[model samples]
Target: MTLPTITVDLLDSKAKQTQKRQLAKSLTKVLSETLGYPDKEITIIFKST
Candidate 1:
């Protein structure tokens, strides 16, 4: 099966590194649990808008 890549766009241009890490971790955890996918298989990409 192909892995899933989740793209997240942040509205805040000054988002901190700590906040991004936390957001990525939380998104990965929730997505993995809800979608039954492995943590390593889920990809989270953050882009500043």
Candidate 2:
């Protein structure tokens, strides 16, 4: 089975962990609905520089 992977880069000065999680969750939900994929098949990765 193929899985979807999302990579998010944090370049903002006010990036928070809670926001990151919410963003990931929202992205996952949108992707799942738009792409007709399952939530378990989606992967979200967050990177901070």
**Which candidate comes out best when scored by TM-score?**
1
lDDT of 2 by residue, 1-49 (tens): 7789999887754778898889999999999999999998899998777
Task: Give the runs in model 1 whose Cα sits over 4 Å from its true position.
Answer: none
Angstrom error at residue 16, model 2: 1.4
- Summed backbone clashes in each candidate are 0, 0
lDDT of each: 0.91, 0.89
**lDDT tens digits, residues 1-49, model 1?**
8998899888867888998899899999999999999999999999988
Lowest lDDT sum, 10 consecutive residues, model 2, at 8-17
Instruction: Give the local distance difference test score of model 1.
Output: 0.91
TM-score, every prediction: 0.86, 0.85
lDDT for predicted candidate 2 compared with the true structure:
0.89
- Name the best candidate (by lDDT): 1
